[model samples]
Target: MSVVPRVANDSDPDISHVRDRGALRLIACGSVDDGKSTLIGRLLHEAQGVLDDQLAAITRESRRFGTTGEDVDFALLLDGLEAERQQGITIDVAYRFFSTARRAFVVADTPGHAQYTRNMATGASTSELAILLVDARKGLLEQTRRHAAIVALLGIRDVVLAVNKMDLVGWSPERFGEVTAAFRAFAGPLAFRSVIAIPLSARFGDNVAAASPSTPWYGGPTLLDHLETVADEIDIGRGEVLAPPRARPTVTRRFAADLVWMTDHDGLAGGRFLLKTGTTTVPAVITTIADRLDLGTLGRVPADRLGLNAIGRVHVETAVPVAIDSYAENRSTGAFILIDRTTHATAAAGLVIAWLDAARDVHAEASAVAPATRAFVKSQEPLVVWLTGLPGAGKSTIANLVEQRLVKLGHHTMLLDGDNVRQGLNADLGFDVASRAENVRRVAEVARLMTEAGLIVLVALVSPLRADRERAAGLFPPERFMEVLVEASPATCRTRDPKGLYAKAEAGRIANFTGRDQPYEPPLAPALVLPTDEIGPEIAAERLIQAILGRIRQPTASDDASI
Candidate 1:
């Protein structure tokens, strides 16, 4: 047995040449048994990319599993998984690589099943060209149309129609032409850049690598030949790359009549301008040039510093001037989305229009202290503690204790008990899945508002589902939302029976009660879990407080003594 030496990039000069030229990534897609896997395996084998040992292994595996008197099933080469071998279907997108003398190809053999359309989409999303296969005898099927539609939707510009199983149909030119015309008619209105059709029998390797004598009437280039010669298309709408840079101007406006403007080269140093009109984006260098100038018409400015939402025109002098527009002209194309430097999440959506003058007027009229001053006076950071557990699991008890401790510390605190809130705020909500989700959503919104108002909010709810908990978590800042799961066994909760709700569920009076009929998916990674079997309510409350504050390094002797 001989081994084909692995081709090394450093040793092969042609490999480097192709790398410089760039690789062609093609995704092969078709309905089941259109020979997608077989086509790819044959391409790999005929191109001498497959090693002898691997081929022998595939051959041995084929003989052991091949039905009755079947020839070497080349599909077996790519269908390596046990599940796929048993089912004889490709369940996922299988990637294979092979190269020819001119170019290297990365092939994605996508699954054809309707259920695996998402996987097909995954394969097609990055593909520059989609090789759509069809059985010559079958003509065109619904699945083929579906695959073509998805290819167009995912923005694949180039398409190669591989009409497989020509050998099964006796290499009929008329049959191939009929299928090709039908496909073209179906795909004519689609957004593909180009559609090239070829007739090939992947099983017998006809018209695949080299021109097959099987089709003398067909005069088109071979599949590989067409792939190697096709010109790489470019998107023309992307504007000129080497155009002379425009001079970006920074304008500064005063609350009075005078407006000062500067250019990138020599513009007025940092001043604020009310965006009068036009969509524009000035360079960040303007921030260095101006100090502070106020403009009229905008509403009360809230912050002392010019952060996001503080937009002003300042004079700037770049080496040149660039045409820019005000953010109000176009929101999507003109405005910029600002993200937090640390978290990378969108912190604020900014528009260039500014109302600095109006902001100063509003600030002059308002006599109340600012929110920052109020927060400072409170001497506590506002946060929301969400307690989730089964009913009768002592959530309310723990929440009450925790709130009392915070109250004693002179912190403004509010407890939104699940049962109490249901009476007033969530009165109209029901126990169905959608209703339950809505109820939790309303509570989370109210809690968020309370936290933002500089009040500590403790919510005690039997939020049985994990999805509901995650939704609540997303509404608040990461540092503000704390999830505390009150862990108690179903038997323990039933024995406690604080509300007799468990008894009602068992007696068939109530339906879909958590831990009785409906499921309670426990939190996978809660901030704190209080086990009622071991820790008393007092200790649990202290633990919850310590988790939230992080300043209480060691539990005081009095704290433990009280528990």
Candidate 2:
């Protein structure tokens, strides 16, 4: 193997006649001070991607801000931000365009600081592969695990584990083996298609762009060669196949996605923003927050709202239809940014998981009979009375009484109690915030279907969060839906202990128990506040029936007399 000395102004072939190989997008990421910037700088410098004058300028800047004493600081080539130069750290994602004789590449040098994780996520959002760097001495760090997890979550299947600064570790093959084995073990569950570990000294340019004789035992392809060949494999593997016929951008109102919340403000349901992806932008609203990732276990938990640096699944609805694709298929068309409409700051970056009603070509078969016609035949307007409160708050009892009164009044009605639904429809759900939100969402949808059948639906649920209850109410027109808060203090509910839920929670047998470990937010301005502690269930039911009667088309005096 021959080694190429790191020299400036090495002449190379012109690219005008070279084949037009497509560009490969990749990101460099790891823990802070892991030599990510240096690795990228070396790759550019060795590939002759840096211009002569640009190199000279960094040489001068190196004197003022470089970490290396006398040697030229290659990291200065990518750390262009002033904050980065002063701190000797990368604060933002710096992208550089470089190419070898075989292929062109766009490389993003992402920050490794835990605080700047959101920036790393931004870079990963578009990258097809990841070059994760780790200091030869450190082996692996928490940030390394985090970056790897984010890469896997974002659909990056290819990884190049660059064990940088090999010289500091004496270029010991034993040490390299130890680090490689540890990484492979940790990354086993990340589902990486390939993880190629390469030991290199970015400062001395060993095993980066060319083969170095520093280690005769290391015989794998050099970094550049592997990247170019990887590109070839990606391109050629598909054969000369035509691109799939993309459907015209679906102009839809809503979509479900996985979002990495970047801002400090907590994101709740009903937050409005501008959804921008590719060239299409639309006014959008966060309709619901579903679940967030638990990085430690890599499992999902229910989320009421997304805090800073939180990765959660959410539902977004747009004011107008926009074109989008699944991120799994096309990264460019599938990723989007949500900008705060008020401040214009980016709130989150999201990957499209599924689009709701995005297929403009497919339509629901319209029913032969109209909902209004069905209601007219029933002699009553369809409605949904949503009752939300804490556990043991008498919601079920009142709902049952109201349903009985409605039936006696010669009106059709259906009652959906939360416990009853849990036994069947929501049997798989848990008591976490996300599960509760989904529980409410499913119940709300079912109530809507029932209302369309011309029956008044009564939903009795301990839908804890105000935002979730509001989302449920948003499903119906204001006149068609009534949000009734079953008011009761925690002490009162605990004393009642209708199902011994409070006892289980007090004994630490139940987690995320409403009014205990998890909080319950009552309706802000409910149509009716049934203080179950003050009024009996029958009286409360009567009050609810009277309030609902005002919203529906009641029988006239003459009609009642004939009956």
Candidate 3:
């Protein structure tokens, strides 16, 4: 092996022709018996990567395992595993490194069995281009569709539709065109960088390494020529191929994944599964299933659960925040495997696409007075009692009573109501969803600040969106934050409209009304649910105060308790 050092300005004019190119990683995959292993073995053999002794051994070995007598089974060079030889199939991803005079290549001959789809994904993560072969005699199969879906998920955009075994079908150009056109239509809007279709026979070595005269009708480059020119443009002056540069990869804390369930058990939402990404492993849950892929039609359909071999777009939440990147950005950081806890079996493989709510860039500043120290000084734990509901859901009525009860109990407390807040800090904001979310965010910030000062804060607002409310709850410790939902039907709220906002909204005098025009998303689960129609604010407020008092009871355990 010789290393060529780059020269910025050289005395020899030939130095200007050098435009640096990196090693290309490729994976060959498609339906089983589509000649994936044969194609790879042929490439390595043509490149002269195999040693003389190894070639002799394989030739003899091929005779024993070869289906065709003394034909030198090219698949034998790749299918070296004992099981693979017995089965006469590539069951694992067989990786090989070879170099042409002009380029270096790393090829992963992935298994085409549908059950081993995850293995194809494993190879595609580090690969940039895929050699997706279809048996010209057999056309496209379910395994071909499955491989395409998985390769797309793993972010391999450059594809080569190798219509292999053309000899078996008499090297028919019509068959090749038919398979190619069908694939293009099936993979419409896939947005891969390039899709080069080439007809070749791995068995006959036609178009595998060089252009073949057998296909006089075919006008495109051979399989090797296309693979070497992946960068698209050749610099005649420099004699180098320049691949398009990619944008910078971003670091994110969250992303949606296309999860492939591999185990027999069904994927359960909210179940704690161990997620392993790169070198980091953490507990995670499939928060929600967005949609699943229907392999038959290649269309997305609504689904809540994934069974064995099922694929779905899902939202995953880790127990702790993770520093991740999109699969398109960095495959190592974006690919992950979910493992079942009881069986300890690999359950599913996931590819991260978009990063949501990333916290990697957020840096927390240290405060001089810690919240614990402030609370200790005041002889009470800090708390944020958040009340959410419709406009006239008796939030303020219950809030006022709760404040009075806490005050009577000698607890220092303050009530921050929606109208009062709008009079000052949020006076400029309107009633839109964005403004409402910002409103809740600001309130949560203020409440967090107040709690840090050892004050019990009561927040009463018609914070409609559950997502906004969840954000507010995230601001404080789980035990210190309480979500109280004041339940009132739209009719009850309109009937008890002391502010008369509902009537005005119904009369077209107002816009963005919570119950009249805009909808409110009530909390699915809350610390307390106050049915104002059944009970008065006083009784509800009393129950809330008791809950708060019990929650704020700090542990009195001492380090010297054993003594």
Candidate 4:
């Protein structure tokens, strides 16, 4: 089909006008039957982007497959496939270019089906704004919420809530208000900068490019006008732009990205693959499967492996360095694909979040007084006593007793229990591997700070992962950190079941339960082991107190006076 030239002449005044306003890349997405294709087609038609021949072709095809009787089906212009015309639904990402005297635009008409969500994501990854269409009659559907979530995830701050099919809804002001209000409320935490709700009828072309006389009570810019004037320029700082050497469009070896695993095969961590992004292709390894997106809730969950069609965050270490920016900044340089090394099959599609070695210019400020001075004044050496074991293993009970004993003996002590810490500082975290690691990291940092204050810190947690425990230990010197295992067999812990955790896990009520669904690797050589099954909490606490007291410096009369 023929097309209309965006500008009639090179010297046309509209050329400067379009350039001044800048081009806008946008995507139209929502649930099925939300009129996305029709809206885009009508926008192009009203903007004078469609040629007479193109209109005629669609008009002829509309007679054969149009939803509208005896009228040109605007959706036919974009529903190019035969199956789409027959089904009257979008199934692929259709990009159409259009221009107005005010601006130029490239709008992607993405599928609204749940199965084609990945296709919608592809379109959204490069868009500056999203026109989230919703059927005025249907209001907000699940797919509508899903698309909105994806739009926010991809970092499109501006959203146009196009409530289409207003004619069917009688252009009711109350209905429009309800849909708009529901969307704003649902999108509150999604972090959208703007949500402009435009009531329109895509099939009838009301409130699309021109203000519809049918909705005289409604006062808002036509969808086209809003699109023509929306500002998309972001203030990317000099350091934010230059700090990522890997973000450079050059080749890099290592980077971190958010990806959707597509293949049936599970992508295990440390597996070798081919990293293909932009113009570069290099051998790569997924060094870590950082986390997977729980799409149902849009939360990050810990994942060691990526399954079919799983959205995951991962770190890729390449054979060489690559030049790419965070996907939020530069879509062209940030998007990538992971291919199997042997089969050469595309395993996943990824968007760069950052380089593993992304540089930071900030420096840490040291205190005037040293930790040694604080310890000497307090007459006690700072130490972190980490107690790790399975649930119901008496770790918390033993830790509480030990801390109480130490306090009575005139020692400064801080006891950090798992449940208490989770309720406050780590409340936002989940039980996923990544969250657990973060949980351990936060506790370890806090423990380190407490040590600087010359206090004995007791951390009682079911730190299931040995790696996480070891990383926490790395924060302190050999003498300053002690790993204590509160040992109890799974059977013994279950019998105790103080919190009913084991029973819940056995009944499949809890997921990722350590010693049941998830693994718990005990410390190879703990400083002390209290077999809780063989000894009482009091006995265990006494043993722990003796061990801690032996390691710490004894208080002197001069040290006491200084404090």
Ordered by lDDT, highest first, the candidates read 2, 4, 3, 1
Cα deviation at 239, candidate 2, in Å, is 26
lDDT of 1 by residue, 466-551 (tens): 75677678666777788889999999999999889988988999987889787887898988899987889999999998886772
lDDT of 1 at 494: 93
In model 3, the runs with Cα more than 4 Å from the true position are 1-21, 232-254, 328-332, 355-563
lDDT by residue for model 4 over 464-491, one digit each (tens)? 9776776677668889999999999999
Candidate 2: C-alpha RMSD to true structure equals 11.4
After aligning candidate 4 to the native by TM-score, how far in Å is the CA of 73 from where it should be? 0.8
For each candidate in turn, the TM-score is 0.57, 0.60, 0.62, 0.56
Clash count for each candidate, listed in order shown? 45, 1, 1, 12
1-563: candidate 3 lDDT, tens digit per residue: 21111111111221222333455778899988898988888888888988898889888988889765768777888897999999988888777777789887778888888777767766775677899999998888988988887778777788999999898888888888899999998877567778999999887789988889999999999888888889633212212122222322333334688888787777765445777765456666576778999988878999878887788988876644455566665554567788886687888988887766644345357877666666665667789999999888899998998888888877778899999999999998888665776687778889988998888999999988776677677657798899999998888988989999988888899998887677888888899998988998888888898899987765232311321
lDDT of each: 0.64, 0.81, 0.77, 0.80
Whose TM-score is greatest here? 3
Question: Candidate 1: minimum summed lDDT over ten consecutive residues — where?
Answer: 2-11
Instruction: Find the candidate with the highest lDDT and give its number.
Output: 2
Candidate 1 displacement at residue 516 in angstroms: 3.0
Error of 2 at 439 (Å): 6.1
